[model samples]
Target: MVVILGGSLAAACAAPGSGNAQPTAAASSAPALSSAPTCGTEPVTMKGYFETGFPIAKALTDEFTKQHPNVTFDIREDQFAVITQNAPRVLADDPPDLMRLPQVSELVKNNLLKNLDEYAKVFGWDKWPPSQLQQMRMAPGGAVRGEGSLYAMGLNFSMTGVFYNKKLAAQIGMTTPPATLADLDAAMAKAKEAGLAPIAQFNGGATGGLAFPLQDLMASYGPAAPINDWIFQKPGATIDTPTNLQATQHLEKWIKAGYFWKDVNAVDYATMMSRFMKGDGLFMFNGDWESGNLDKQMPGDVGFFLMPPVQAGGKQAAMSAPLTFGVGANAKNADCAATFLDWVATDTQARTIGVQIGGSHPMGPADAPMPPIAPGTVTESTLAAGAKIAEDNGSMDFIANATGAIYAKSWTPNLQKLVGGEQTPEGLLKSVQADYVSQVKGG
Candidate 1:
């Protein structure tokens, strides 16, 4: 996302969209000081199903149990695909207290999630910025997201961008990361000449790893609102636009230039990451969530940067989303689950642990400081990129989140076709847009 460093970081450390002033005025000033709602000392055991595994939730629970010593958790972690696929059965048979809800609109439509409006009120969550509150809302019958009553909240904020191997960049005679799309092309050409994979990619399993960058490039050409409107399935929104076509053409151009790994389609996520860590590639187009792993495996050698703007100094935009979750309507410990969910925002210990362990931006109130990331580290760099996105309000939801089945049904397979020589950029976009039309129209 595009952030002028000073303004973005300032916004990150204060209220988003608010002009300079007190960083700790709203909810951050007042801790979790609402009524002492009780979940009893009966050893409240909550079963949590998550798309994200142990680290984030575990950290929160570790701190949460300190306040409510009677609470215990039985958390079941799974890959996003598995949890999303099983959501129906899980909800039908016996639902966990906290369930990662990817198809939040669908569940809300089915009335399977506990409406969080009451909890939002009790926690004083209305005090947060309007933009954040909007993301959590959905209209009655779940026909629309980004408005109405709250259904879910993200555990941690996330950002996506390019992760570059600084050492590799320097070896190619690059003094700094690219400042524009043209600069990126030059760097890629240089990396190619140096026998480096300019873009470390894996399209064999999921196209999101590749497609999201393209989407970000498209976003850079226009305002963030249209992209967000399309993703949120806003009325009259269309993805078959000129700028997105340019983005798709650009992806094809990179493919033809041999910028991506030749065997990218055969590689998997783990292998792609392993290769990037081993310095086999100059750049990896992905997200900040991977910062924790890169920090562990490739310390000091890596850095993160947003895709340069289309022009030398234009605004940048990228897809971002909260690591979202919901309470099950049938959950036994629903009250306890709501309490835990509320703590993610109101509790300082939870916020600190979220940043430190998850490399996540905060989902807390305006006055909350950006995570105390250290200087000159990749984590700090990524957080800076994220801070800018927040500051500029440049982030839009991931396009894949547009619909429950869009990734498997549309994004990945169509992108694979585009890169595999079976589809034109225009053809591929039409194909994906067709699916969106069908989904929205119930055709």
Candidate 2:
């Protein structure tokens, strides 16, 4: 059973049932292969559009082409900011076999995406963690997520956490990672006094850098049900509360204490990450997806840890979302695309390559080997941290995923003001809540 929050909301629209029976490869009208085709000799080419996650996609397609010499792929990769708003416009004129979905509800409502439920059954994807599956299901009319028709699947999965600089941590008289939020606070203060930025973050364009940290911290303060409900757009859910207020105020306090980069407002994500890679800060609030870059640039210097609990050894949670992808309604080679999607979950090489090169967890067989980890490497620490989150079942959706407009309409702007000393934390929270009510709730 899926461990989704808001039982009523999940139950509002029923998911089509698939029992414990395996489905055949020729589950749809697609031609069945003779001699058990690992690849077919058909002359077909697939087009795709994506924002990030290209490494995993490229790896899969490259390997697949080796198996079938006639198959080819032409995928366009772009920065997420460029394609997010223009998804619909681009899809209308130039549809690909697969594309990254930025506005799921909008795309679903407009019939722009193909439902993956049939493919999900054919692939027996139900065998994966139901929680992961839940993230892809969307109710009719796109009013609810986590149930109904399947629309997307993640190429890779990631969880948000704190990335620390070992050299800087020790320079501040710290020998071990923080075991609690209090310890993290003290370590940041010490790092600041040591003339290094405590947290290298960017809130200038998208506030995810700060928002994720605040959400991770808030996870420790109360039951995750309420928070998850709000993120899932449960009708009565709200983020206006003591715990969230405290989380917001905590970020404001950090900004006031100069814990963030001095030019945080002016700095964008690329610049902030570059600064952190240069060891300009003690900790960077980010996701495990950055592990690949860190592994390449500062292999032995960086490490990862989820935000510790309010008290040591308490339950921990982190904002996690799949690096999701969807099929276009007008996809030319969807059958082959489905094969590629299923391969990620069934083929060991695809799964391993995704983890090793993409720096993310795999949804393959349960017994799949964890990627080899090197001592003092970001990959080692991040994989370990990701394991704990999975063990605890502490994954939650990104807060921005609550609605299509949440990030640009509220979060980035309000958070900019909060960090700029132009808006109070409470004011920022209120503004965000207003956006949720307006866009998600239609209030």
Candidate whose lDDT is highest: 1
lDDT string, candidate 1, 1-443, tens digits: 45688787866796542442222222112224356355777878888887665488777877887878898778888888788878866775677888877768777666667777767777767787666656667877678778888878878778888899989999998888889888888999999998888999788876446776678778776678887788777888888899889888888999889988888777778888889888888988888889888888988888889878888778777677778888776667767787787778767778878888878776768787655777777878877887677677788787887888777789888888777888898998888889988987782
TM-score of each: 0.88, 0.87
Which portions of model 2 miss their true places by more than 4 Å?
1-40, 206-208, 441-443
- What lDDT would each prediction earn against the true structure? 0.78, 0.77
RMSD of each: 13.7, 10.2
Candidate 2 residue lDDT tens string, 266-367? 888888888988888889888888888898998677878888888899888887778788777667777778778777766777777888877878775456
Q: What value of lDDT does candidate 2 attain over all alpha carbons?
A: 0.77
TM-score of structure candidate 2: 0.87
